[model samples]
Target: MPVKYQQETAQITWEAAQALIEAVLKEGAAQKIAFSIAVMDAGGHLRAFGRADEAAFLTAEIACDKAWTACFFGQPTHIWNSLVQESHMAPLASHPRLMAVGGGYPIFYQGRLIGGLGVSGGTYEQDQEAAVKALSFTGFDKL
Candidate 1:
């Protein structure tokens, strides 16, 4: 292999990220809940974020962490719970941005990892539902 080879990368567009945020908010409204939603690029950088007027302010950071966990790990944030159970893996929990909650999911398109979506301000199950609903509504792959 060449010392410095090129590689292709796919990313979530700003338009798509905005649409995902809107869809999550819409889902929250339909469920009579407030939510903070965040979208992160494949590299775990914040791309878009939004919140319902009544959502808890603290949920902003939680939402971003959730998305960061999912995107960077290439798995749902909740998976961290089981992954860290082993003694040898316990230290992984110390990573500040690793959210072991159910609201974050990786975003994929045609088998390509594009980004991640996260929702907060409700029960973990509810947050997960919102994230999944938005991904489905906006034509993103569901995890």
Candidate 2:
């Protein structure tokens, strides 16, 4: 028997991403409210994605950035949004890759950070809801 040496890279599967998208769509969200959903690996690199028909070009990029920000910062992007509101922290806007916006959330499994999700192209609340739902549908249900 020959032993094979292959390095395995951590990743989220496409089925998981699709499940998330279906869940979000089933929530009565309209097609006109297109969404750019992004998923990032544990290292904050893009793993998978989906963009609705009406989603804007910027939507995808922003969504990815939000996911990366959440995963890399190890906290909900909403926290960064909130912190930016403080007079003392306004300068964080200048921080490279720091997005003071909603729609970004971390995905955790077994109490470990495994990935992140970001949704765009809807109202802030809607975007947040979709992102959370996506995480839940992906089997990180408690996220």
Clashing pairs in 2: none
TM-score of each: 0.95, 0.79
Worst 10-residue lDDT window for candidate 1 reads: 1-10
Q: Candidate 2's error at 59, in angstroms?
A: 0.5
Tell me the tens digit of each residue's lDDT in model 1 across 29-139.
999999999999988899999999999999999999999998988898888888888899899899989999899999999889999888999999999888888888889
Error of 2 at 98 (Å): 1.5
Candidate 2, residue 15: how far the Cα is off, in Å: 3.5
Instruction: Give the poorly placed runs of model 1, Cα more than 4 Å off.
Output: 1-4
Q: For every model in order, what is the number of clashing pairs?
A: 0, 0
Best prediction by lDDT? 1
Tens-digit lDDT track of model 2 for 20-129: 66666554254357888888888888887888766789988888888888888778788887788889989977877776688888777767777777777888788887
Candidate 2 C-alpha error for residue 139, in Å: 2.3
